[model samples]
Target chain A: MDWNAFLLSLKLAGWTVAILLPLSVFIARHLAWRRYAGKAFVEAALALPLVLPPTVLGYYLLVGLGRASPIGQLYEGIFGGPLVFTFEGLLIASIIFNLPFAVQPMQRAFENISEEIRDAAACCGMTSWRKLWRIELPLAWPGLMTAFVLTFAHTIGEFGVVLMVGGSIPGETRTAAIAIYDRVQAFDNAAAGAMSALLLVISLIAIGIANLATSRAGARRG
Target chain B: MADRPTGLDARLVQDAPIPLNARLRCEPGEVLALVGPSGGGKSTILCAIAGLRNIAEGRISCNGSVWYDSEKRINVATRLRRVGFVFQSYALFPHLSALANVMEGLGSGRNGGSERRARELLELVRLGGLETRRPSELSGGQQQRVAVARALARDPEVLLLDEPFSSVDRATRQRLHRELGHLRGRLRMPIVLVTHDLEEAVQLGDRMSILHHGQTLQEGAPHDIMARPANREVARLIDLKNIFQARIAGQRPGAGITALAWGSTRLEAGYNRRFAVGDLVDWVIPSGSVILHRRRRPSRGIRENPVHGRVESMVRLGDTVIVAVKVDAHAGYPLFMSMPVHAAERNSVAPGERVGVSLVRSDIHIMPALQPDGHDDANADP
Candidate 1:
């Protein structure tokens, strides 16, 4: 509801998108192109956050970064504090919560590319890195943009993961979604209405921008 | 007939089986066509030579250096092979402009001047000013031309094309073939092309290797293969339609000839060195070489081989007429004879009418009967 909470939400969403954009592309490409041991199992594991209850995911994150945990101990040794109740921790949680949403669309996009194109590149003696940079990534831009926008919006709308891992630390962890909950709990219906409207407008504009970019790219290709 | 460095030498052996086991030695300026049916491993040989498919055994050498050797554990990656490949689908990068697609293979150091070379190659293929256009914006023929230009941009030691004309229209395909002929003259790279069209193979290949079931059936000039197939399979594949079961009726020692009898039709043929007096053999005569006449003419000074028949059916193909003539009282089988449409018109031959077909003794080729598999039918001597 407050401007600080709104700014914190924006920052969390921004960082999540920044980190996940490249990571999701890698994941999507891996799932789309390569054959490896236990690939289906890894893909299913990546998708668990989409189907599993957010609170359950939050509980697992809580256990994993609870100071005494191995990851929590590693973070504490590096950053001199526990990862729980920190902005970095919330960002990590939001990324985990929105990964499947980010990766699935991009994976589908990469899957649609004909094997003829890959074979053509191979025949041309282009290296794998060259093919990825010059061919695969460019063809998959629209899907990548879709993943970015959807992940950002999904991260902003998240509530359960933030409540469990973020701990509502005001300017640090109390995101807009969490702030709206707080305002509703305090019976400040007007503030909640205004925050919900802002979230709705942001999502609409993001979707419109993504559509425009995709159509422009498609037109250029045509 | 001048000897030059053979363009590519590839020997591929995989775990399953050596699907491609060939030693091709082509001159630097010659076009060697690898023609076969689908899944005959023609493309596999090309890929192995290009360093695209890994061979678990055998060795590949191009331009006097070894590119791949399974026993030595030496394999050059595709990028280092300096071989150009044009795929059947014309794998032009959809995201790149035509010029960029052609320039993608040029090294960064050569990037500045490669555009001119790209344009030149494009012009060579008759795709002059479409450099800025993407692949999707071009027609199928233009796309294939762009792909060809891209392959030639590196001026590779050997150029490989996999069904280069398979995706284009007939007019475009003919044009592409002419362009390929011109490029072959200019580049002087040993161009290895894989094609399923027999006519295209015969037209384009200076020398050809006919493959069947992953094995080379025969390799020679296209006309040589057509006129004198090594076996029955090659004869059938080359469209020799008059194959019949015959017995060695007799042999003429001084004339270096043998007599053969098929039903009531008797013919004299050149004596096959491998034939014995009592050996039963299959004789193949190309339909195109058989001359058809409506009425029997007076015997000439020398009558080599002649047969009387009734025209059973006539199938017109373009400018040629394939006439299936029934010899003797054969139940349903007919001997095929091909003649130009003008010849058929002059003779006024029609189905169910009596006609006489004549072939020289040199055209009467005899070989051993094919095994049950019929694998040898297409390669038989004609």
Candidate 2:
């Protein structure tokens, strides 16, 4: 059943969400609140990976992190391993691909909070951090939950970006999606069906729980 | 109580093309009610004092500490200003219970008795049992009370209320007014109440400042501001509905009555202004100060101010009846007189009936017609 590939896929998805969840919230809040020159350009650049073909994004990441690239050379000079065709490379690619998935919902949530409540919090002697933690976080909890679930599912279901960037090294970067493809190519129908069902079930459970949780929160907001 | 130190002065020019310049001070245990028309920079004054707004060129200080000074480049953060603010919308935290909302205002130094303090504040606002309920679970007035309790939790040095009772029903507003009056006695801070409601301002303020556009037209005791407004606009804003334009004919120096010419009609009013004899003057008498008598019967007091007219209309608002009378000699609109509904019934006054209404000699307040360069030069009172 290619157990190593399935475990690698799960590990990748878990790490991606754990790291991106908090980071995206900060990014979302900054995008929601602050205004500066070139803000629109920066936002559009960040969201490019969402609309770009996954393979195209993967190609850019490959070039950006290849041994010939400055970052790739710096990393190789430090660690003695090329950055491409590695698990770390896959993780980075996953985060970029899922950028908009994580940010948009959280940004929308922060924007929906009334300005009166924000001013009231400031008048109540709350620092910016305290106001965000106490007032904004609680009210935007639903959007945050949606962001987490969408990012988790998107990471797990990823195939094109990881395939191009990590080259599907078995037990290293050969995620469950690659394993299913390999199984089909080898005409191993039973094993392919089993892995596909596992991925399907995982995706379904993530989406189902997100819907249920956000619906309850939505009712409270209403 | 001793005098509370204050030097809160601001001359802001950035909100619009014209600068809003207002200076307000409240001694210890007093409220300076800032009454003005809507868009008259009343709330802006409160916000500027609280450091919630940036003033282009001015200084604001409270209790001898500077909150904002443009010359020194000192601007204190809003939270550290230590001012309690109550917004018109109540601005309660929808997620937090009433107790938590109040406790949140106590900040990090709340110590161990936060719960007790919050409960006591809620009890003070008459919301003891509702402390556990979230703002969404409370009524509008209840939420307003929670906002007040939360503002007071920090024990601020200055209190600013921005039309705090505007959103509630009239009955609830009256109750809130009484509660605010009770609260005013317990807290001796420099309190500022910003409202467009003239009656509310006259009732609650120990001292009243009348504003228009961006300038403070007059500031004095409520009775004085009402009885002797600075200009035609101020007279209209303070609810003196019987303002009329008359040309100054002569001044009776000793008796304090100015002989005024209203079209072809001659009148005597208590005016002390130094304006020239040929200058135009705007004068007002309180609706209640107007005496009404049958046309056949003579006016009891001074005969010069009496106008023989026909009753044009009568509007009954609660206990008072507003009678509009068209004078025989006046070329324009009718004069308005308000009296008790019982008095109207007793006098048997009705629309189209002939009557004699006398503008009380002592009740007449006069000011120069608003200048063309004045902020409110358009002079559309209605």
Candidate 3:
């Protein structure tokens, strides 16, 4: 069953979401509300990973964070380990790869909050933190939930980027998707089938939950 | 510094994205209605005072507290400014219950019994039992009441209402108006209301400001502005229908008469010395001030600025009939008069019929003419 690989996959997905969700909340909010020069270009750059070949992205990550790169050397000097082919490297890769999945839904959620509602909040004497905690967070919950679920599931099922950035080290970097691929390559059909079924069910459940939340939110708003 | 500012005082000047050159003042317990046409920057003025909008150069202060000053660079954040604003759409949080929405405006920190205060506010707005219902669960009028209650929860120094009654039906608007009237008696803050409906402005405003193309042309009591607009544009804006160009023939101050040359006919008006004897001017008399002469009667009012005209159009609006008379002295100009349907029927007034009318001299207001090619005041010319 490759239990270590499956647990590692869950851990990577967890860490990726924990880091990306908070960061995406701020980024998505800024994109939704503020206007600036080159805003369209910035958005297009953020969405680049969505359409680019996973292997191409992986190659860039390899060069950008490999042992020979400055960032890779700095991390190795500080942590006594190379940046690539480690759990941390895999987590970083997962976050970057899932940027669109994590941010677009949250951006749309923030955009759905009408300008009048925000103006009313300001006029009500609510501070920035209070407005976010009391009003924005509650109203944008469904999109945030959808973002978490999609990012988690996509991170778990990723293959090309994971393989390119984190070479399949058995317990450190070999996630569930890599384990499935390894089993197929080794002619272990039974193991491959079990892992594939698990991933398929997980993805379907995630999508189903996201759809339920969005539809409920839509009905409530209606 | 001679007079301590007690309420809101603001002057805004901007050149882009809805140009504004407006200034307004309202004392405590006074309602200043900003009445203008659509796209006239009425709402923008309210937003500027509330600190929701930015003006290129301006100073806005409420109760002696400076909310925005471009020269001093002292722009206060909207949350720090104590303003209770009621938007046209209400803008209630759809996720929260009515009670929670009101509670949100109380500001965090004093937690004990804030819920009670919210409930009391709801009760004040006549939504006592519906506190737990969400905005979507309430009717449009009910939602608006909740919005008002929420705004009041801020305990603000100024209340800004932006077409608050526009979205509701006529009956609901009337009821809301009555409720607002009732509510204002207890309020001690200045209130700024923006509306395009002149009738609504006249009914609610202690003073009304007429705006056009982002400029405040005049501000005064509604009755005074309607009776005597400051200029030709204001006359047209207030729907004064009997406006015509005339030349001053003579001014007899002792007799309280200003003779105007209306084509070949000389019409007497109340003495106004603002214009010289040879000056061209524009004059207006409200429809109500144009008295229709009864058939076969030489009434004493006929001795006033009497005129002969043919009725061009007769429109019956419910109990009143509006008769547009084409004056014989001025070929293209028409004088409009309105009277009870019975009075109109008794006079046998109909289209294409000739009639005599009298323009009340005291009611005829004269203003400097606008430029021949543009809306700029003719007074600007040397």
Candidate rank order under lDDT? 3, 2, 1
lDDT of each: 0.81, 0.83, 0.89
Model 3 chain B scores worst on lDDT over the 10 consecutive residues at B373-382
Clashing pairs in 2: none
lDDT of 2 by residue, B175-241 (tens): 9999999988898787888999989998999999998887788899999999988887888778777
In model 2, which runs have C-alpha deviations exceeding 4 angstroms? A35-40, A215-222, B1-4, B7-11, B15-19, B109-111, B271-273, B295-299, B302-304, B345-348, B372-382
Docking level for model 3: medium
For candidate 3, the per-residue lDDT at B81 reads 92
User: What ranges in model 1 sit over 4 Å off?
Assistant: B1-6, B14-19, B109-111, B247-253, B261-265, B294-296, B299-302, B329-332, B345-348, B372-382
The per-residue C-alpha lDDT of model 3 at residue B59 equals 96
Write down the TM-score of every candidate.
0.91, 0.92, 0.96
Give the TM-score between model 3's chain B and the true chain B.
Answer: 0.95
For model 1, the docking class works out as medium
Q: Kindly report, for each predicted structure in the order presented, the TM-score of its chain A compared with the true chain A.
A: 0.94, 0.94, 0.95
Give the C-alpha miss distance for residue A189 in model 2, angstroms: 2.5
